[model samples]
Target: MAAPTSEPGTFAVTYRWGLPLDEAAIAAVSELTCHLLKGCSPGSSCGCKVNRNLTRLVRQGVEMEMPDPTLIYSEGRTGLPMADMWLAMVNPYRLTSPSRVYSPDFRRPRVQQWP
Candidate 1:
């Protein structure tokens, strides 16, 4: 799912992983989504810095096969620290405007849940 944005060059991308995910999987994918929001440019090759760095980070940081959905829930939460180590990595493009990362209500589809 994606939220509407008025910016011409910006976009919103949401990954709806059905519930039952452990905290670690949620964290990994959330981090991945944040990298995507930081601007994976169109026509980017596999060598795109965003792609390369995020992949490496996931591999080293998580060290697990990306898990499949394991449980179901009405609501959950996820945190993305835009000002933390994520920003320490190289992002050649600008941050996607109006970017937000959170756990959505799987039962309600695109409805976002608050902390």
Candidate 2:
């Protein structure tokens, strides 16, 4: 698959894996997520930072058919990452925003209260 065209420094370094993710994959992904979170701005929410980076990694992994352990971690935290990645990759220009959907700005009407 073609290398991601996004700007450099937007994502973390690529991780190489001998095979698809296993239990070890979980540990690796968590470690990488922590590392990525460390670099985010102090005011930035940890959950958001983790999710964004992980989502990018997973999307790349699925398309390439080689799951990077780091990206796999994102999937472990929230299964949606892998599925979201697949959808995003298929429709690169799609405007769908997970953040707005999952964690909406409270200023707006709280529609369909979440459990």
Q: CA RMSD for every model? A: 19.4, 23.6
The residue ranges of model 2 lying beyond 4 angstroms of the native Cα positions read 1-20, 43-115
Give the per-residue lDDT of model 1 (tens digit) for 1-115. 2434766666767787867866555666677676665557677553325222122234445763421222111112122344333433433343545567666654555878999
TM-score of each: 0.22, 0.20
Give the number of colliding residue pairs in candidate 1: 2
lDDT score for candidate 1 against the true structure: 0.45
lDDT of 2 by residue, 2-38 (tens): 4464855455467787767655455556665665676
**Cand. 2 TM to true fold:** 0.20
The best candidate by TM-score is 1
Q: What is the overall TM-score of model 1 with all chains considered together?
A: 0.22
Q: Give all candidates' CA lDDT scores.
A: 0.45, 0.51
Point to the candidate with the largest lDDT: 2
- Record all residue pairs in model 2 with backbone atoms less than 3 Å apart, i.e. clashing: none
Task: List pairs with backbone clashes in candidate 1.
Answer: 19-71, 20-71
